[model samples]
Structures are given as C-alpha cells and as structure tokens.
Target chain A: MKKLSRNQTFMLITIPVLVLFFVFNTLPLIKGFMYSFTNFKGFGSYDMVGIRNYTDLFTDARVGKSYLFTFKFAVLATIVTNVIGLLLALGLNGKIRAKSALRGIYFVPRILGGLVVGYIFGYIFTYILPALGLGSSMLSSTKTAWIAIVIVAAWQAIAQTTLIYISGLQTVPADVYEAGAIDGATGWIQFKELTFPLIIPFFSINLVLSMKDFLMVFDQIMALTKGGPAQSTESISYLIYQNGITGGQFGFQSANAVIFFIVIVAISVFQLNFTSKKEEQL
Target chain B: MNKKNKVAATTNWPVTILLILGCLTVIFPLYMALVIALKKPSEMTNDIAGALSLPKSWSLENFSEAMRVTDFWHSLGYSIMITVVTVVLAILIHSLAGYAIGRCMAKSKFYKFSYLYIVSGMFVPFAILMMPLVKQTAQMGIDNWFGVILCYLVFYMPMNIMLYTGYLKNIPIALEEAATIDGATTWSTYWKVIFPIMKPMHATVAVLTALGTWNDVMTPLVIMSGTGANTLPLAQLTFQTQFGTNYNLAFASYLLALIPILIFYLVCQKQIINGVVNGAVK
Candidate 1:
C-alpha cells in the first residue's frame, strides 16, 4: 500500500467534501444568483428580466412587509434572548443551590424541536392563554403575532444563551466584581464597568448566532400560525419557502433566497465592522 | 425596592428571584404539555385549567391515541432512525474535517478557501436551491431515509465543522507529536490518543447535533413533504390540515415529542454545563 504524505492524504479527504459542498451549496448559489436576474418561472428559460426582479422585490408591498417582519423579529429576539440569556447565565454560574437542576430546567425549552415548540406554544397561546382571554388567536393579530413569536423564541433560546453567558460571566475574574464591591461600586456601576464590557464578545457571538437562527426560523412560524391571522407573521424566509414549495414559484423563491443570502452576509459583515469600529472608538 | 436594602446590597437575591420565576416559566409550559397529554379527553375539555394545575389522572392513553392518529409509533421509529444515523455521521465527518483543518493550518490556500466558502455557504438560504436540491435528490434516488440523512449531513456540516475546527485549534500539537514519536501511526494516534482527549468536545458536538437534528422541522418537512413521511415534526403538523382541530391531542403529541431530548438533556446536564462554562458551545 502506498502511504500518502499527510498533505496528500488531507487533500484527498477534504477535496471530496469541498466538491460535495460545491454541488450542494455553491452551484445552487450560482443558480440562485442567475435566477434573480431572469423571469424564469422555475423550470426552463424565460424573459431575461435583468434587475427587474430585484426592483420588484423591493417595490412589492408584500415582500417588503415580510422583510419588515423579519427585521423586527431578528432584532427583537436578538436583544431579548441575549439579555435574558445573559441574566440567567450570570445568575446560575455564580455560587447557587441546585444550579445544575435549575440549569436543566431552564434548558428544557431549548431541547425541544421548533415544530414541537410551535405546536406546544400554539396550544398554550390558542388554548391555554386564551382560556384566560389573552387573545382569540396568539398568531393572528399583527402586534400580538410578533410578540408571541418573540416570547416563544426567547423561551427556546434562554437555555442556550444562558449557557454562553454563564461561561462569559464565569470567565470574568472574580476580583473585578469583588474589587467593585469593596469600593462600593458593586451596583449598576459594577455591571456597567465590569460585567457589561467583559461580556461584549459573548454578546456579539450570541447576537450573531441568534440573528442567524431567527432569520432562518420556519417551522415554528409554520406550525404556530402558518404566518397567519392575515399573514402578519410572514418572515422573509417563510415567504421564500411559501413561494418555492407550496406556490412552486421556484425561480421567484430561489431569487428571494439569493437576496436573503446577500442581505445576511451584508448584515453580518456590517455588524462585525460596526462593533469592532465602536470598540476602537471606545 | 428599598434604598438601604437595594438590589446590589443583596446577595444574589435579584438573580435568585429571576431564577425562580424563570424556572417556573419553563415549567409551566412543560407541565401543561405533560398533564394534558396524560389526561382523558373528557377531563381535559371539562377542566383544562385544573388538569394543567396537576396530573389529575395519569395514563398512557393520550399518548397511544395521538400516536395512532399521527402514526406515532411508526413516525417516531423513522425519526429515531434518521436522528441517530445523522448524529453518528455528523460526529465522524466533522471530526475528520476539523482535524485536517486544525493540523494543516499552514495549508493556507485550503484554509482560506474553506473559510470563505463554508462561512459564505452558511448564508446561502435554502429556499432558492430547494428546487434544485429537491430535483437533485429525487434524481439521485435518495428520496427516503437516505435523502433525509444526506440533507442532514449537509445541514449540519458547516456549524459542526466550525466548532470542531475551533476546538482542535485549542489543543496543543505537541500532544499528538509525542504520540507520533512513540511509534504511533496516524490512525491509532487519532483513535487511542487524540480521540479520547477530544471526548468532552465529542460530547458537546454530539449533544448539539443530536438535539438540533431531533428539533429540526424544515429539512424533513420540505424534503418529505409527502404523505406518510411521519417525521416527528411532520406528525406535529396537526393544525395545518383541516381536521378535528384536536388541540388537546396535538398538545399531547407535542409533549410526547419533547420526552426523548429532555431525557438526553437531563443525562448530560453536567457535560452541557461544563461545555457552556468552558466556552465550547455555539
């Protein structure tokens, strides 16, 4: 048997993965990009629509509404989940009784599948909460739909984010908080000066991850309201999904997917740059 | 609420109160799921608020019945098969890719290309290419368990690879070098020396993958959007179709859906806590 050099063997293994990635991801990406430029319905050729598709997507009221909803969800869920998660993490990571059990309890929702979360929460919203006269449909009303989605997302996310925050919080030198306490700076001053600044890196990573997951969430939306009452909960990803699958507007949906990809990448880069620049200025 | 006994002067009280409330918040929904699942239909309808308060009567009928309606046993069987296979495959493939990337850091071209490609691929929304992938998978005759597993393999790769790569970087190369000096072959070195060392990491990866795959809905929902696909999430689709509006049964199923992962969560709380505490999580 001819023993391949480490580099040769490494390439042999990874090249196939890269190739598969191209087949599954990169090629499809190219196809998506191309479709965004055309009026292809899904299958074969169509009118070479140029940038009209992009123009239409922005100008169209429905598409824009979904984008607005998505932004609201991503931004809100991102903030709330991180804040609550961080709070939980800090609380639990400290010397506490039954921290393990508490951690387990906090994480139960995170362990659930999105569909199950949607269904279970949908039940609570539609059946349980409404029995107390909360709302007719937890997913139907516009204001309430966003709120419901946020609450549910937060619930599922608390455990995971808390876990991140716990690590971040624990990693902060105990002497910092202790020094603050000794100096009578242990209150909001301590958190602002010590905890907040220290955990920023965790916050950024968690924020990005939370945003990514929130942007991609579909199952909960589908199972919860199917983006309804009156399409009030229709997120950008869901819109693409509806167009692609149920409507079979493959080309249109694919175009939206490509656009979504570009927007996310732009947003991520923008976030990183903005935060890093802010840090430099600080 | 008081000035002298302010929140800061407290010893973890603020955190403790929030922890109590947070634990209750998670428990309430979980309790609702379980109690309602076990309660008789008549009892549930008559006294849901009471049933939710505590288990008035516990039995497996609701579970079995919901299972019957949703093809519960068959669907779970399918789900278990898919999730188990996918988890195994994810650990194996991701470890290899991660090791290669970690050891071959000087392989700049490969690293650069992968960094650009994999991270970029993450932002590639699935909607656009669902059409092509659906077509491709159908063409490849991977339209069953094989199709689902392949989709999971692709879905899971980027994140796991990212994680493994990061983790492998943290380990010292001298550890592996010492093994090599002791006449250890590459395979044995990885298997006996490196693999054992990577256990905590493996546990983290396993928990994440298993939990994530079990919770996934969109992949199977879209891929097997056919009747009889019966993934756990698909079975949770009781609300979508015009049916009995069996909210109670749906909640029953939702509760049941959580059991497997909840068990895993309970079992691995320590590992998960350490993983989170050690900064090993997503």
Candidate 2:
C-alpha cells in the first residue's frame, strides 16, 4: 500500500464504485441507450434501427402526456409544498408549546416508505374519503388527478420542506424585519421584502428537490392508479417502466429513458445555474 | 395608523390558520390510518369514517393476524438484513472512496472521476434502469434479499459517495496526515482518524440509508418478487387485500411498517437533526 502509485491508488478506490456502477447501472444504461437506436425486444439479437424509437415516442400522445403530467406535478408540488412548508416553519418558529412533539408528528410520514404511504393514502383516497363524501375517483379521473397527485406529493414532502424552510428562516436578519416593522410594514410586506429575498436559496432547494420528487413519482402512481382510468396519471417513470418492463418494448423504452435522462440532466443543470443566479441577485 | 395596526393583526390570521391546518393535514391522515388499523373487518366495512375513530374495543387481533398473514417476523428479519448490510457497506465504501478521491488521489483524475460518478448519479433517474436492473440482478441470481441489498448499494452508492465526498470537503486532512506520520496505515488511519471524525456524516448516512432501505418497495418489488424474500413494503402493498375494507388491519400494517422507522428516527433523531441542519442531507 505504501509503495502504491497515484494511478494505483485511483484504481483501488474508483474500481469499487465503477465496477458496481458498470455492472449495475452504467452498462445497463449504455445497453439501454444502444438498444434505443435499435429494434430489440427482450429476446435475441436486436437490429440496428435508426431514430425510429425516438420518433415514435415523440409522436405518441400517451408518451407526451406522461412528461407533461410529470412536469405539472413537479411544479405544483414544489409551489404548494414550499409555500405551506414555509408557513408552517414561520408558525412553529415562534415560541410554541409542544413544538418538539408536533415536529415528530409532522415528521412521521417522512420516515415511512412511500409504498406504505401509497397504501395508507390509497385507502384514504379510494375508501375513507368516499365514505365522508369526498370523491373517491379523484386519483382515477384525468380532470382532478393532477390535484390529487400534487396533494399526495405535498403531504409526503412538506415535513422535509418545512425543515429546510426553518433552517433558511433562522438565518434571516432579525434587525431588518424590526426596521420594516417600524416603517409600518404589514405582515405580507415584511415577508415580501425580507423573507422572500433572503430565502431564495431555500426556494431553489425546494424547487429542484420537488423536480426530483415529481420525476420519480412511480410507486404512488403504480399503486394508486396504474396509469389509469384512462391514462390520466401517466408519468415519465411509470412510462419508462411500462415500455421497458411490462410492455417489453425495450428499444422504445430505452429511447424514452435516454430522452428522459437528457431532460432530467438539462433541468438539473438549468436549476443549479438558475438558482445560483437567484441566490446572487437576491 | 390604528387601522393599519388592526389590519396587520388580522393578516397574521392566515399564518395561524395555516399553522394549525398544516399540522392537522400532516397528522390526521396517519391518525385516520391508525384508527382503521385498530378496528376489525366488521368495523371497517360497516363504517369507514366511523372506523377512523378510536375502536370501541381496542383489539390486538388485527396486529396478530397481520403479523401472521404477512409473515411479518420473517420479512422483518429480512428487512433488517437488507437495511443493516446495505447501510454498512454503503457507508464504508463511500467514505473510503470519498476520502481517497478527495485527498489521496491526484487532482486531475480525481476531479474527473468525481464528476463522472457523482454528477451522473444525480442526473439519471432510477426508473430508467429499474427494469433492466431487475433483469440483470435476476440474471445474476441475486433477485432476493441479498439481491435487494446489492441493488440498494447500487441505488444508494451514488448518494453515499455524493454525500460523504461533500462532507469530506469540509473536513481537514491534518488528522489523517498526523496519524499516517505515527505509522498508522491508510486503513487504520481512515478507521481511527477519518471515519470517527466523519461521525455526523456517518450518522446522517446511516439514518438516511436505513430510512431508505427500510422504506424501499420498488426495488424489492421489481427484483425480489420471489417468495421468501418479500420486504415489509411488499407486504404493505398487499395489505389492502388482506383487510380490504378492514381499514384497521391495513392501517395497522402501515403503522407496523412505520414502527421500525419511528424507532430509527427517534434514536438517531439528534444525528438526523445535525445532518439536516448541517447542509447536504438532501
């Protein structure tokens, strides 16, 4: 070990992650990517088809709907979760009784698996709520599926977002707010001038994280809707999975995945750059 | 001026209302679920809404039946195996790789390698490879609890490296350097000096990993669909069937899924708090 060269050291360390990545992810990813350019079912050798997979995927309405639904969910979840979460933080931040226990109660859902959540909430959505006259098919129908999914997504995410907001809120300059108060600044005005400006970074965190969350909303959809009453809840993750695994359209699925990959990477890069700029500007 | 003061006081109502609403929103679903879980099948279908209240007669029958039906003890053990092994292996490998990549290796290659693994890890969504990952793992004959553990490492390794590396950047190398000078080998120096020092990160990673693997359903569902390898998540997914109208057993099982995590979250609550507050938990 002492006699090992720098290159040797790199090999020693990088090899584990790299091997695991290659065997598990990178290789399959490449295989998937390559197959996307071909006509491979899960069976034998695949033909080297051209851009057909990409063309078909784009031309398909259901495929396009998945991305749109995913994007919409991400947007709504980010906004709702952050706004509510920030409000929760601001409320809880003040001298409150039993804050710790309240925090634990709020934080419980965050700790449980999403499948459990999906089941628990699925029971609520499909059964319990209906018993109380709330519509049961909210998740099943196209018109209200968006709101249902966003609500569920927000419910699962608010605790973490609340924590983030609390962290962000703690660093706000107390004196600036006091001065704003002296100037007869109202509650809304103080938040607009003080809280909003200083907490822009937290907002960015909330946005990007929600993006991640929305993109990966699979188990919930799978459990709750299975992409249906009429494909209302189709999402990118679920779509890729259907194409790749269930439908066995490996080539088309791979194309969808690669495109999905590019979209995600692009969004993440854009978010990072955009948020940093906001952080600087604010 | 007095009107303005009154207006300001009235406006704060939104915050107060939102605070109570947010807490209720967070807690009531779980509360509802718990209420259902404690009820009998007879109580469930008779009145779903009424079933959400405390049971007229609190019964441990649903729990015992849930335990028997889901084969709760076996799956619990398997869940423990999956969580413990994945958490240990993921942390150790990541910390080692993080330390070497950050300090021990040459700058040029290290930077490129770091970006290769960590950055790409962030961009590609897991759903893209989930299908193929399942197939590949099945092909490798690890489509069981062990497979679940390995899959977790692959799924979570990126996160571990990304987190530990970020934390390591904040850690000074002087301690490791001093240890090396005193004839401590690289491994021991890492174990004694570097590892312990990264305790916050360790605790964070452990809790995070445990939370993740314990809560995981998709990976297990995809890969380990075989008998004798079902996780608590898979059990919970089918909980609806076991007590379909009996919201009690369903929610009971959901709460059971939650018990381990709640214990985990409480035990490492401080460490988790430190991690969340310290920046990089996300």
Candidate 3:
C-alpha cells in the first residue's frame, strides 16, 4: 500500500461523506432552488418561467394562510411547552423522592413518534373530548382544530424541553440558592434572579428548537387534522407537502419552500443572535 | 437555607401533588393510546368515559391484529435496520471528518469553507428540498430503504459533524503527536488514540441520530412513497388512512409503533437525557 500523508489520509476518509452530502443534501437544495424558477412538474422537460412561481406565491391564499397558522401555532406551542417544561423542571429539580422515575415519566411522551402522538391525541380530541361534554370535537372547526394541533405539538415536545430545563436547573450551584435564601430572597424572587438568568441559554435552545419544529409541523397535522376544517392548521411543511406531492404543483410549492427556508434561516439566526446578546447582557 | 429545606420537606405536599397531576395530564394522551389499544372492538363504542375508562377486559387481540395489518414486525425490522445503519455510518463518517477538521486539517482553507458549509445546513430546513429530493431519489433508482437511509445519513451529517468537531477540539493534540512519533499512520492514530476518547460525543451523536431516524416521517414518506418498503411510521400512516374509522386498530398500531422506542428510552434514559443536555449546553 502507498504511504499516504496525513492530509491525504484525511482527505481520503472525508471525501466520501462530503460527496454524499453534496449529492443528497446540497444538490437537492441547489436543484430545488433551480426548479422553483421553472414549471417543472415532476418529470419531462420544462421551461424556466423566471419569477412566475415566486410572483404567484403572493396570490396563493393557502400558502399565506398556512404561514399565518404556522407562526401562530409555533408561538403558542413554544410558550406553552417552555413554561410547562420549566415548571416541571423546577419542581423535579427539588429534593423529591422518586425524582428519576418522575422525570422519566415526564419525558416518556417525547420518545413516541410525532405521527403516533398526533393520532393518539386525535383520538382524544375526536372521541373523548366530546364524550366528556367538552363541546364538540375540537378538530371539527378551524379555530378549535388549530388549538388541538398546538396542544398535540406541545405535548410531543414538552418532555424533551423539560429534560433540557432540568439539566439546566441542575447546573446552577446550590450555594446560589442558599445565599439568596439567606439574603431573604423569596422563592419566586430567587428563581427570577438566579435560576432564570443561569438557564437562559437552555431557554433559548428550547425556544428556537420549538419554533422551528412547530413551523415545520407535518406528520402530526397529517394524523390529527389532515389540515382540514378549511386548511386551518396547514403548517408550512404540510402545505409544501400537499402542494408538491399531492397537488402536483411542484414548482409553486418549491417557491413556497424556498421562501420558507429563507424565513426559517432568518428566524434561527436572529433568535440565536438575540439570545446570545441577552445572555451576555444579563 | 434550613427553613427552605423544612418548607420543601413539609409544606410542599400540595405543590408536589399538583406536579404529579400536571405530569399525569401531560402523559394523558399516551395513556389514552394504551387504554384504547387494550379495549375490544365492542367496548370501544360503548365506553362513554372514552380514554379515561379502564377496559373491562384487557386483551392482546388488538395488538396481534395491528401487528398483522400493519406488518409491524417487518416495518420494525426495516426501521431498525435503517436507523442502525444510518447512525453507525454517520458517526463514523462525521468523526473522521470532524477529526480531520479539528486536527490535521484545522488550518486548511478547505476546512474553513467546509466548516461553514456543513454547519449552515443545520438551518436549511429540509422542506425546501422536499420536491427535488423526491424526484432526484426516484431518478437515481433508490426510492427505497437505501435511498431513505442515504437521505438520513446526509441530512444528519451536519449536526453530527458539528458535535464531533466541537468535542474533538477540546482534546489536546499531544496524544496524536506521540502516536505520529511512533510511526503510526494518521488513520490508526485516530482509531487507536483518538476514537476511544470520543465516547461522550459518540453517545450524543448516537442517541440524537437514532431518535431522529426512528421518529422521522417526512423523509421516509417522500423517499419511500409507493416503494412498498414502509418503515414503522409510514406503515402506521397507511394503516390509519386505510382503516380510518377503526379506532381500535389505529391506536393499537400507534402503541405497537411506540413500544420499541419506549423500551429503548427507558433502558437508555440517563444516557439519552445526558446526551441531549450536553448537546444543548455545549
């Protein structure tokens, strides 16, 4: 065998992975961008229509509605999940008995697939809620369906967020709380100044992650509402999937997708920057 | 501090009760699945309490039927295969690239560019590439398990590489330098001297990738569509759609899909939770 230099050996091992990344990941992104400008509808040849797909997106009400619903859902889900998760972490972080088992119970839902959670919650919304005299099935109308979607998404995500928060809580030195107590800081005050500031990074992580996930929500929507009740809960991901795969409007959906990608990237970058700046400021 | 502990040890009962109730509420949807899955078909219609009602007679018939209809064992095997292969290969590839980037290739221009290229992928949002990915995979004659696994490998690479690279950066180069002085090849130095030290990152990467692959629906939905090689999620989707009204079987399928992952999580809960916390904190 030839004696390969260190750099050469590094290149040899890394190239295959890089090639696979390029072909499957980068290439699709590039092709998706290219296809957005054309009338390409699956196979065969197509002419580039310049910015027609892009311009047409403005006229697409479903895409707009999906974005609106997705943003609303993302915000609601993120807030609910983080708040509930933080509360759970705070409670579990204390010297509770069977704390590990309780923590495990809290995180159990996260291990289930989103699709499965959606279906399970769908069952609850459709049958149990009505039977319990909680009015009609929440999924029967646009407004209520969006609530169900948010609830299911939060349910699916809360466990992981709680776990993250618990870890963050565990990191704050016990002395910090002891000193706060000695200085006559109440429980709420201590949490605000000590626990909250120390765990801000974990908060940012959960916030950004939940927002991104909720915006791209698809499988759950598919299982729960199927974006029904007049497509009230069609998230960006579901909208793109519907338009591209089921509706055969690949080009138009690709345009929506490209815009969606830009929006998500912008949001993520902005969130990280904003949060990190806050972390430093605090 | 003594007062706080005394309060936590005594007057916290109500709050602890509330926490238990809250945790129960969070996990209620999953409990619903198990309840419905255990009920017989006749009981499902008559159970007025719905998800809250315990089955008068618990049976495994629904499970067996769900297993038969959804091809649960086959799909489980397929999902396991895909997750295992993708996770193992991704870790190996990412570690090699990460090792190179964090060590020998640290000062190279390619490393700088490649670092930004790979990490930028974390924000690209796979929805943007969905349509093109579907077409590209079909065109490549790999719209099957191979294609799905390949997509997972590519989609997951950036995060895995980021983790491995960041972890490797903290280790001193002295060990590798000593190995080099002993005339060991670059490859052996990584495998023998460096790889073993990456146990924690490996744990993080493994848990992260494994959970992602096992729970992912969109990629498999797009890539494996009509290929008749369904993973567990896809199989459950098909089962639900086909048996739209059969709540018994649907919930059973959902539970069947959930059991393996639940077992896995329970077994590796500590490691997985630690991995997630470490991934976020770092």
Misplaced by over 4 Å in model 1 are A38-48, A278-282, B1-18, B45-56, B175-188, B238-243, B273-282
Q: Model 1 compared with the native: what TM-score?
A: 0.91
| Cα lDDT tens digits for candidate 1, A164-279 | 77777767897787666667765678788888888787777787778888887787788777787678788887888787666756666666777788888898888888777666
The DockQ-derived docking category for candidate 1 is: medium
Per lDDT, the best of the predicted structures is 3
Q: Candidate 2 or 3, higher lDDT?
A: 3
True contacts kept of each: 0.56, 0.56, 0.70
> Model 2, residue A103: displacement in angstroms?
2.2
lDDT per residue as tens, model 2, A117-193: 77667766776677777856576667987777778778888878888778788888777766787887646887888
lDDT of 1 by residue, B1-282 (tens): 235335445456656777878788888877777777776666755334654755566677767777777777777888899889988887887777777766775667766677556656666667666766776766677656678787777766777777777777778988878987887666557778766777777777776777767777767766676545767777777434622665557667776677776776677777755654443334
Better of 1 and 3 by lDDT: 3
Candidate 3 local lDDT, A1-282, one digit each (tens): 987899899888767767888998889999889989998776668889999999889988988899899999899989999998898888888766667778878877777788888887877787787887899999998878999888888887988899889888878998798788888876799888788999998999899888888888898898888889888988889988987887878888898999999999899989989998998997
- How many angstroms is residue B220 displaced in model 1 relative to the true structure, after the best TM-score fit? 0.9
Q: Please list all clashing residue pairs in model 2, or write none if there are none.
A: B36-B248, B37-B248, B37-B252
lDDT (C-alpha) at residue A179 in model 1: 69
Provide the lDDT at B252 for model 2.
71
Q: Any idea how many clashes model 1 has?
A: 2
Q: Kindly list the per-residue Cα lDDT of model 3 for residues B148-229, writing each as its tens digit.
A: 8898888888888888888988899888999999999988998998999998899999988898999999998988977787
